[model samples]
Target: MRTTILLLLAVLPLTLMAQRWHITGFGGLSNYQGDLQEKRITTNQANGAFGLGVQYDLNPKLSLRGGLVYGKLSGDDKKNTDSFLVARNLNFTSPLLEGHILAEYRFFDLDNYRFTPYVFAGLGIFGFEPYTFDTTGQKYYLQPLGTEGQGLSIYPDRKPYKRVQVALPFGAGLKFRLNEMVTLGYEIGWRKTFTDYIDDVSTTYVDPAALLAERGPKAVELSYRGGELKDGNPNYPADGTVRGGSKVKDWYYFQGITVGVRLGSGSGPFSGGGGGKRSRQTDCPRNVF
Candidate 1:
């Protein structure tokens, strides 16, 4: 009986320490939805996304997760088979970095099953720099140009948009416990943003004359890029013409596999002779989730 008690005490600390925290690493494809994306999912245009995160299990059913992710989003009118979109001749790419905090809910008690489905929701902010290449292959950042009459004397109603925007991320995933310390997960998350200018295309075209005077001639050239239309003698859109939809906002997505592992600390949950019931449930359960 004394030997069994000693063995239980030794095992208890290890189990609690293992359950406290986990580190996650993930990588996968990313895509965006906006005026440029006629289709919701464009695999050919998918960009790379990667992230590193940490998780703290609050209970058998819930956890708190925090992470930083980097994703690249891009869109081009040229990729569209739609006749009208092809004539638009505009394209932009934005690389984003985001930090988020989320709550994760497991549908089944993790201790009861090796596999579980889960859902997560979080708030985050991301920074993006939208850029496009000119005919000479020189890259230009679009925000400075105020493409839609922003930051211009002629258009006081239009304000310069922010480079960093807020977003809500929500998603679901399925995870499989590979071992006592490691788990694998497949997740797909959508970032619903508050801003529509992630691609630097929104609202109506600004007057070229005004943009040239305020920003530069290059600004005017990039503000309306239909000049390279496949059909000869392309007619550029006039000022006040629709450049992008104003009513709807842009969105981006991430879908990938995550590998997680628990790395314990000396003063963990099960340290200093914690509750025996909690420690026992870590190894043995009377009922399943």
Candidate 2:
């Protein structure tokens, strides 16, 4: 991390010298798509997200940007309109945090053309912890419980998923120059994540008896919410029953407006950018006539 920071600083002068440095801040709604609510773009569960970034334009059409973003993502079958989903009654909310380095390609130059549409793709590392509340409103973190049989010696096929994972972020946006020193943009980005456990509902249901023995009653309660739905028994699905679609992965989205400031030039010639030729001052005596 230290090396990376030093490298960025070293590159800053080069970026600004070329009249291509920009610092930006973005904030807006974020949403998730997974087993809970497949194919829905509705904002019923939207959460807040914000980010700060720096960009270096390599040319009128291409640039490189690095930034950090944070947001909250949640999914609740109880909050879903689908009757079958609401009956499933499973839910989880997790904080989303990541740092990304992306390459952007623009259709035009906002600096000179006034407006531009662009696309970006990048890699990121994100951390998340999924949790939910019990009937008495007691909150429980689901990871250590081995829900869906994760980390259980008996369930050889199910392995524990990590709290931090890799993400692929790609999307498009439009930018408008607010002035020579500032720019405004709006973008919609999607993150394809490797872990399906972001919501802690992947794989099949585990045996209640075994789950209870290993992780306690709290695990059993969280592993299966439908048991208390309308029936006294939670064993209807039995073990190895489908609790979540493991075949499909999970994804999250970020869309928001950005405000950015151009850096360097106005500060001073010694600050970095090309100084060009220093023209000689005119003779003062001639102006007195």
Candidate 3:
């Protein structure tokens, strides 16, 4: 009984230490796909992104991770070659902040291989507020302006959309073990969002008179920008004119390199202990050698 108690005490700390955890830092470029950007993925306006996270190894092939990432997204109608888009004449930029929890699966064992390709899928919540600068360089946020008649008494169906929304994150990456203490990798992840308003242009246009009366002049000015463009449509569309595609939701993605450091010195069950030495027996020591 005494020996068993002593063994339990001695092994508990080592067992806890053997649980592998990593602190990770990531830096990369982020881009978006929305009404303004017709392409599925483009680097035309990619912006800087970075994140910090913690990960735990569930076994040789699985890991669970959680982290926060911040990035910027921007799009412009003038940059598009499509004449219809050019005539629409809209542009926006927003800062994206996301918090996510993901499960990762690796193709190779970390203990035996120096490199591996991995995939991850998980859930996240993100926040964003789209804004644009007028001809005079005055910046205006678009949501509260109710560009599509959101929050208006006349449009009962066009409810105000929240700035924060949920997203599904999934992607693949390659990882290289720098050493037992450090690791390096590159990952590309896409966030599938539930809302189409990330770019602040969804659904049809509202009546300019009503928008002006309710949200004021700035709202009307920013809500429909085609008139501001040279050779663009001088007249704003009538109420219910299609402003954006509401059927397809917006998507954002991040691609970058990651660096991780192991949290403790104790080796996991399969990793084997240091110095190629056999593990000491767990039974209580008979006496000091």
Candidate 4:
């Protein structure tokens, strides 16, 4: 991490010297697509998101940006039309914080055109902790409970997943330059994640007696919530019965407006040292005047 930071510091000045710098801010909504979600994408549980970033226009066609974003995501099986899902009765909410760096390609030049459509792809590292409220309205974090039998000695194959994971972000948007100093745009971006546990429901059911004894009753209660629904099946599934998808991973998306403020001259000599003749004034200028 130290080496990476030093390298970025070394390269930033060079990038700034040759390119236009824009400090950007983002406001948008974020939503997730996971095992509990009824569809791939929807605004049902979308939450507000905010971000701040710095963009460098490398040239007319390419640019680079890095930013930090904060967003909230959630999923609930109760919202689904599928009967099996509604019976699952699982729900979760997580606050996601991410840092990303991306390379953007613009289809048109901003110098001559007022607007341009651009696409971007990048990598990100994000941290999240899924949690939900119990029937008594108490909040319980899902991970440490070993709801899916994770972290239990007997379930050697099921280990606790990391809270911090990586993601691949790619999307397209349109940008409109409002003036010489300000630019406005909107974008919709998707993050393909590596883990299926973002919603805290993955894999098969664990023995209720084992979960109750090892992690306590709350663990078992939150894990299998089917009984909580009205006239819902109260019997717990067998130890190996499927509780959630074991194969498919999860995804999240962000869509919003962006505001950018341009910094420095668009076309100017390098801010860093450049070879140029220095100007000098004549000493006799006062006498001549």
Candidate 5:
């Protein structure tokens, strides 16, 4: 970590000199998709995300950037009519705290327009929290089976799943100089995570009876509200089961598009330097008539 900080610091001056240091922030929308209830569900979800950080110009051709970003992804799921007799709805929301270190290379730099186009790729770390809400308006926490408990939503007493995973962040964007001291840009990127439980859905289906037997009535009701009971007993196989939990290895991904402006010193590749007739004059010098 110290080495990483040092490396960033070492490149700071170069970025500053090249007019590369920028304070950027952005907000955008994203959707969550993948295995839910044994079916692939893609919902039109809305997301908002923003970041604040500085970029270092390694040179006119390359640069590095890092920032702290807070983002959310949410959507709703409907039960599959064919496989399950119960009618239910699942809603989920995940807020992530992410940090990204990216390397950017510019493809075109138009001196006349003061605009640059670039592409970037990097790694990030994210904190994930996933929650489930049932039709009854009650919320139940879920955990991966066998990690600390026996079944899904079984331990109502336990906390939600919190994990730290590595992420791959890649995207492209364009920057336009508003002036020497200001710049504006827009970016679109995708974050690929290592965890499969972003939506609180995975590969295996749960036996409703077995889950209820372990979790009791409160949990069963909370997780399966608004659904018809084809089976009378929680352990009875005849009643439809909750699909998901068989380990198929899944990951959560979110896409972001942002537009923001930066404020900084106007000295760099586009500033044209500080030398002119004004340099020879003191404060408010007047021309002799």
Candidate 6:
């Protein structure tokens, strides 16, 4: 009995030192630049973002984490010069408040390497706003005008628009345990947004002149001159002969990648200590976005 008591005492400190729950926080710089559909227009911008969250180890092989993230995404405008000559030079920015829940599985746990690799996927929701400027030095909230003969319209009365959309986030990462309580790691992830109008442009139409007036023309011309604009014909061919009938569609998509770090405690059920053990370890859950 005395020998058993001594053994329990020796194991108590190690058990207490084991990590069961961990809190992680990190900040980093990110940038996104890409085209929408076949539009030749390009968007490029850089910004900083951060995340804070907590993780609970259900066992040595599996864990769950939940956290909040804040960030911004901006891009260049698309230029439309078909039947409707709407030359839009716009930029988009969003203050995203997101929450994510992820399950992680450590695949490679070696003593000398002390590195664990994992994959995770989650969902997020965010707020978005897009701003536009024309060649005539006008600034407006609405998309560029799509009118015939006349130039871009300037609509100042249009109320600011905001929308919430679901986001799919998934990626793989590597974590090197610097110590029992501290982990240094890097992650690469992709976020896919559900909204197709992140650029603030969609299947909407406005008078070019009115839009230009609201948004000063800085050499930008929003004019419609195609068969579709003239007689409401959607079957208008792209022949140079067709005149005075074109409309602009405000549709776009958002995609980006992020890198960050995580920190947490070392006490866990499967840290080879006294906590309950898990039967049949499993890999990380797949992305649900």
Model 1, 18-108: lDDT tens digits are: 7588999989988899888867666768899999999988876788999999989999988988766667788999998999999999986
Quote the positional error of residue 110 for candidate 3 in Å. 1.3
Per-residue lDDT, model 1, residue 6, is 100
- The lowest-lDDT stretch of 10 consecutive residues in candidate 4 is 270-279
Steric clashes per prediction? 0, 1, 0, 0, 8, 44
- lDDT per residue for candidate 2 within 1-289, as digits (tens), equals 9999999999876755656777879999888898776764657789999999898877767889999999998998867777766767888888889899999999865543567889999999999998989999998888988888887778887888899999999999988866567778899999999988888977788788888887888988887777767754455468877788888789988999988787765422232223432223312321332
Ranking by lDDT: 3, 4, 1, 2, 5, 6
Q: List the residue pairs that clash in candidate 3.
A: none
The better-scoring model by TM-score among 2 and 6 is: 2
Report lDDT per candidate: 0.82, 0.80, 0.86, 0.85, 0.56, 0.48
lDDT of 3 by residue, 10-35 (tens): 98766655457889899999999999
Better candidate by lDDT, 4 or 5:
4
Q: Give the TM-score of candidate 3.
A: 0.90
Candidate 4, 1-289: lDDT as tens digits: 9999999999767755544778999999999988888577688889999999998877766889999999999988888888998998999999999999999998865554567899999999999999999998999999999999998888988999999999999999999866555779999999999999999987899999999989999998899889999999999889999888868899998999999887754431232222222113322221232
Over the stretch 1-289, how does candidate 5's per-residue lDDT look in tens digits?
Answer: 9999999999765655645555666666554444443333233555766777777766555778888888776645544443342334445677878888999887743222466777899999887666665546666554432222244465444343456778888878887756545667777676666666676654333455665566665555544434434433343223334444435544444444444333344345542344222223221222220
lDDT of each residue in 218-258, candidate 6, tens digit only: 31232221222334433322223322222432222222333
Q: Which candidate is the best by lDDT?
A: 3
Stretches of candidate 5 above 4 Å error? 1-19, 36-43, 79-88, 110-113, 144-162, 222-264, 269-289
Give the least accurate 10-residue stretch of model 2, judged by summed lDDT: 277-286
Q: Estimate each model's TM-score.
A: 0.86, 0.84, 0.90, 0.86, 0.67, 0.55
